[model samples]
Target: MAFDEGDAPGRVVNGLSVDVEDWFQVGAFEGVIERDSWGGLDDRVERNVHAILNLFDEAQASATFFTLGWVAKRHAGLLREIAARGHEVASHGWDHERVFRMDRKSFAADIERTRKTIEDCCGERVIGYRAPSFSIDQRTPWAFMELAEQGYLYSSSVAPVAHDHYGWADAPRFAFNPLPWSDLVELPVTTAQFRGKRLAAGGGGFFRVLPYAFSRWAIRQVNRDEGRPAIFYFHPWEIDPGQPRVAGAPLRSRLRHYTNLEKMAGKLRQLVREFAWGRIDVIAHREALRLEAEKATLHRASA
Candidate 1:
């Protein structure tokens, strides 16, 4: 579909994304649940994703799935199903490794493995990425340079909020080129100013813990007030309240991971129904291309 066309002036097309990983793969459970044990765990991803696909269908929305290569290798059929249903299939790295933990070589290999796995699974070139846990931050600004060098068209790995685990609190709240002359657009996760502080408005734990009414209002404020589409994301496990709880996780991790799972699917339905949603490439590529053209034009005029 031509996402660049068919929008009225100033219309906001919000992005809906799903981080395609199982409950056991979440960063909160990393220390508690070893990666080696991932295979033995019961697979709830297919069931959960099928439910999500149905929800999107009901809302007449399309989304981008930032799928893990490990999950894609194990659940290729599910990955294919995401593409068949008209959603964009992108990489979420080979494993759930945080970008900050990997050296340059390891990071390159991880992205290549994921890009190939996703392209092979969905038969589409993967151009977008979201780091595990939003791992890209100020110290690892090279992550953006690497993404550009590795042929990524855009990235949604930065969350412009302060967090112990990951965030670049001062990054642009909306999409912008990370490098002055590169085409690689960095679309940070959505945030809204609240009481003189930036609060997480993008979906995930924030979406689960906060009242649905508040999330709805926050997203609307981004679109209507800020005149920019909000980038909302969630995990399939988020909708599976019955999923097994990790035993050894800290109290804080447990609370963050398990809160309001049952309500997530319904809230997602309402969110999609209430806004115009599309794949990230469909929504952000045009802007990136426009910026590149403007830069080239200015360079020529200056020269």
Candidate 2:
């Protein structure tokens, strides 16, 4: 159902999120770089994160940072900095392990560890999660059950697009409760329908590869036409044009990862300026209240 602007009477507030992981730790490079070797790599995350923080500050916007537990363990101060700036801290898993790559037991342990690490570092409850590379699809539907059980209020792990590596093509394009009995909300990554096709406008490689105007138009369409807040996400590495390039990754991986790195930060600034932004928790609460009100109305009508 299309939400009408008359219902809200203002610009829709979109969600801004960042996946905190180094360039080499990206899923495309997992085949080449072992987790054990990550420590030996140059620590560029601090500088890159600082850049993003500065950008957000300039925009006077708040965002949710879905950070890696492994990064928090090593750079607790960084997570604290994010919280001090008033942005929400959430989990991006203990490491960069994809949900499908792990079994139930392992996935539980991974999220639990990450939650603890983030909470311990920032002293704030980590109530949201976005699986690495949008990996929580039908094959890993149990991931949602685990997320709710583990205290996550919502997840932004499903991308409703067709891709070689990951996507759930038929998933709902807006925020939704995946199960009737579960409290967990599944906020799929934002996509905009264009020329009879649903396109990825929620950032990552799409934000980089596509012209910034395309993303801008897509997000505008979602906000104005659909009247729902769009969830836009990007990686810290996307803004770091000087980050070390991975060697020997497949041709496709290289193109997806390295394209338009230098232009990302500028495009992000434009995006932040163009739209209202909020944390995932804010959207979840609003959606929950709307659902509750709808249920109450239905009950009164039935009575």
Q: For this target, which candidate reaches the highest lDDT against the unseen true structure?
A: 1
Off by over 4 Å in 1: 4-10, 293-303
Error of 2 at 2 (Å): 26
Off by over 4 Å in 2: 1-9, 296-303
- Put down candidate 2 lDDT per residue, 87-163, tens digits, no spaces: 89999998788899999999999999999999999999999999999999889878998998888888999999998
Model 2 TM-score, 2 decimals: 0.94
Question: lDDT for each of the candidates?
Answer: 0.89, 0.87
Model 1 TM: 0.94
* Candidate 2, residue 150: lDDT: 86
* Model 2 pairs in collision: none
Show the lowest summed lDDT stretch of 10 residues, model 2.
Answer: 1-10
TM-score of each: 0.94, 0.94
